[model samples]
Target: MTDAATRLATLAEEALGAPLPLRIRAWDRSETGPPGTPVLILRNRRALRRMLWKPGELGLARAWVAGDLEIEGDLYEALDQLAGLLWERDDEPAAGRPARLVTAWKAARDPRVRHAVRDLVALAGPGLPPAPPREEAGSTRGPLHTLRRDKQAISHHYDVGNDFYELVLGPSMVYSCAYWDRPDAALEDAQHAKLDLVCRKLALEPGQRLLDVGCGWGSMVLHAARAYGVRAVGITLSEEQASYARKRIADAGLTEKVEIRVQDYREIDDGPYDAISSIGMAEHVGSVRYAEYTGILHRLLAPGGRLLNHQIARRPEPDEEAYHVDEFIDRYVFPDGELAPVGRTVSQLEEAGFEVRDVEAIREHYALTLRRWVANLERSWPEAVRLTSPGRARVWRLYMAACALSFERNRIGVNQILAVRTPEGGASGLPLRTRDWRG
Candidate 1:
């Protein structure tokens, strides 16, 4: 009889109609495929059962999260090899050749596929459906983007422990994209540069009031207060963030200059802030509430005040309506989060009564940032697993690595859109000369 790894490889190639890219190491200590390749560790039959039950990206994600599927070599290479099989870049329905999705859907009717599934069932053995790991979030509990639901969504992602975050995010504790002078800049320095870049774009002046929406751990508020002499209000839904930020503020003796609130952006009553920064936050706003989110910030800012909106955007789909959230991201990393095209983001800001000034696409910066983050997590792997769970650590590692690849390939991008609420004279506060935001 053939070993499990050989059987697995044969079965997978036959069912998917493609070669298995990664080397296979089965539970029986049997291995197959060439040397020096990434070995995919399939710990047990349950891993196969996961694939059989869900039969797509979610299935793979489940097995990975459950510590059943693991890679023993270069993770990026493994992901790169699997990308074409998993994430199809083409949005058009027309596939000149039969796509994996079409092939899977026709599996029942096709005799070859039916035989493959029967073999897969025998290989997977008998088992009830495995429960998802405790780290995974359930499906959206309430109406999307409601005040309560938003809080829950925010908490799900952000409440994963400040210690763990500090390890992953480093001393900066800034979760957004960093402005890298070069590809190899220090993480802290790059993060500082990014904060300063935002302040310059907003033209922060002495005693100006700034509002930072979705501020993570008060990095922006503290930086602005210390460096630019701005009084700032930073708000987030995560209590852990608020607590961590408040302590940082007090320690820095900037308590008087900055306020950290565990409050939703919608609940902010006092407004007319001189400037606003919503970095890496609007993706959580959901497309349905995007207009409202932009309107809120526009209303909150005084006339001639600048708004720096930093967000991640996906490639525009041909049908637009054909776009959907990645199942792994929605379920594991960012619950109920959504991304829009950069053009759509600019249009919505313009519609909300803001004159969009500059749109900078710093796609490569994010790829670098994510790689640094992955390095941080991998460096502190044991501590990270101790602080969070092994499952959560794995989630971070996979998502960050995958996202880094996404950024590098331009499958998605991060943009900084600087807009302003122009007064009646239509005079924007920006200088006559062009200011380079990327430094």
Candidate 2:
């Protein structure tokens, strides 16, 4: 009789028509596949059953989250090897579900794959489908990106314990990508440089007003107030973030210079701010509401004021309607987040009545930043698992690792877009050599 590990690999290959890139270690202490590759550890039969029920990325994610599947050896290498088969190998504009269904339907009719499926079902054993991990996001409460639904989404992602965040973010506490002068610069320096660069681009001056939308833990607001002498207001939906930011402001004795509000961007009516910085926040605005979001920022800024929008961008699909959010990301990471191409975002900003000045791609910087975050989490592994659950920690590890690879491969990117609310005469208030501000 075939050993469990060998049988699992053989059956999967029979269905895939290609060899798996890694080894597998089964719960029965059986091992198979390439000798030097990372081991995909099946800790129990439940992992197979989870995959059987869901049958794709979500099932794989659920198994990992439930502590039933484990990765041994180099995690990044393992993911990179599997990328061809599982993620980030799109050959064309998203074919959408109909095309995928056609492919699946054809595969289901293949006799070899049918035989493999039967064996896999028997291997998974007899049981009800496993419950999804508790950490997964539940169904939306209202219309997508509605104020109520958005709030819930933000809370789900950001309200994970502050201490846990502190462990990952370190002392600087900035959630977005750090600006790096050298590839090996410390995380703190990189983060400070990022904040300073944003300040310089906006030309912050003493007594000027600055608004930071979707401010996580008030890092940008505090940096602006402390370094540029600007009065800053930071808003977020997470009560935990608001409370933490308020305390940081008070501790830094910046209460007079900075204010942290538990508020929504849509609810904010105070306008004519000298500058606005929306960092890593626009993704949650959703494609449906992004124009409204950009327009709101445009309306809030005073004439000649600048807005620095830092955001992640996905490759634009030829058929935009075919672009589907990643199921693992939607359920386990950012619930309502939607990444748009940088071109689309710039167009939307222009439509919202801003004169776009410059667009800088910092794709590599984010890859570096995520690598640092993963290192931080790993170094504090015992505490991180204690602070959150093992499942939540696993979710972060997997998502961050996968994202780092995505940025490296240019499958995704991050950009800092600088635009101005030009006045009647149309001056952007920018220097002729604006590139110097990036440093």
Clash number for each model: 0, 0
TM-score of every model versus the real structure? 0.96, 0.96
lDDT at 226, model 1: 96
Q: How big is the positional error of residue 299 in model 2, measured in Å on the Cα after superposition? A: 0.5
Per-residue lDDT of 1-439 in model 1, one digit per residue for the tens? 3489999888777766767767999988899977788998989989988878886678888999999999899999888666655554543345332245324535567777778778878988988989998889977765799999989888999999999999999999999999998987899999999999999999998899999999999999999999989999999999999999999999999989999988888889899999999999999999989999999999999999999999999988888888789989999999999999999999999999999999989999999999999999999899999999999999999999999998998889999999999998988867776475421
Residue 181 accuracy (lDDT) in model 2: 94
In candidate 2, the residue pairs with backbone N, CA or C atoms under 3 Å apart (3 or more residues apart, or in different chains) clash, namely none
Error in Å for residue 375 of model 1: 0.7
Predictions in order: lDDT: 0.89, 0.90
Report the C-alpha lDDT of model 2 over 233-351, residue by residue, as the tens digit. 99999999999999999999999999988999998999889999999999999999998999999999999999999999999888888889989999999998899999999999999
TM-score for model 1? 0.96
